[model samples]
Target: MGVRRVAKGVGDLLIETLGEAVAEVILNLVACALLGCLALIACLCWSFSPRLTIAGAGLFSCLLAHGAWHTVRNPPKGRRRGLAALTAVAFTSTAMTALFLLLYATGCDCL
Candidate 1:
């Protein structure tokens, strides 16, 4: 019974550590994505033209595709997987939103 308790304790510790690591990774990804968005927005403001707007939208679409690829390739297999997946989805969605906004600002219709 004592050995079983020790094994369970170790397992719990491993799980906790994994959870922390995954959280840190997700945080880093989010930070990077936000920075990218900010830079894109700044560029758009400085160059308020249709070409610049289209470029911004293309950049965002690329970012979304990259994130989706990462999410699909690695996937979240356990407790950490769900958080990782969520992070990817969030990043992709934000990029798509930004792209749409850029398109709208440029008076471009998507059809």
Candidate 2:
């Protein structure tokens, strides 16, 4: 009877751990998707309306910063690779945003 109880408890613990991991994975995926969609929309809007583009880029930067802050605080297991990738993406996006602003400020005819 004691053995059976221990086995049941272990099983419950395993299930709970698995559920939490799954939830984390889903949330990360959703966040990545949202960021990607925002970037795409902002790029598209850049040619149409500078105001809309700025809004989208600002939102994207805020979300990215929040995600990075959380990840740094918690440092999830097996997520180092993901963090590195996100960092690379963040740099590129930031550069692009800066370039857009610079062009706009200069009143570049190319834009």
Candidate 3:
């Protein structure tokens, strides 16, 4: 029947979409992990210099905030507000950390 054929087509399309989404998520996780490892190495090597260390942390915070903001902007399905709130928390924390580091690096004894 036409109804059966349409249902089968819809199912197939859903399966294909799910498969692609899963694959994309996996690929993104792998890439992020690799880049994170590289950043860790660079940070470790740069630890001998205070300025460089601060720079690295600041750069990392900026990147994290950017990513979080992007996620907030594009929000995922079925829990958009919750996800946006979580991302906002993440962005705020990163911003605070970066600000603290900057102040400390600049010789503030506010600790």
Rank the candidate models, highest TM-score first: 2, 1, 3
Q: Per-residue lDDT of 17-100 in model 1, one digit per residue for the tens?
A: 999999766655555565567678877766778777788778766766766776667545555455455657767687676675
* Per-residue C-alpha lDDT of model 3 across residues 12-92, encoded as one tens digit per residue: 999999999997666555545545565688777687787887787797677677657756586566654654565577777
Best lDDT goes to which candidate? 1
Computed on alpha carbons, the lDDT of every model, listed in order, comes to 0.67, 0.66, 0.66
Better of 1 and 3 by TM-score: 1
- The per-residue C-alpha lDDT of model 1 at residue 105 equals 34
Best by TM-score: 2
What are the per-residue Cα lDDT tens digits for candidate 2 across 1-111? 999999999999999999999976665555555556756876779889999878877877776785556545666575456655576467667666556445433432222
**In candidate 3, which residue ranges exceed 4 Å CA deviation?**
48-111
- Residue-pair clashes per prediction, in order, are 1, 0, 0
Better of 1 and 3 by lDDT: 1
Candidate 3 weakest lDDT stretch, 10 residues: 102-111
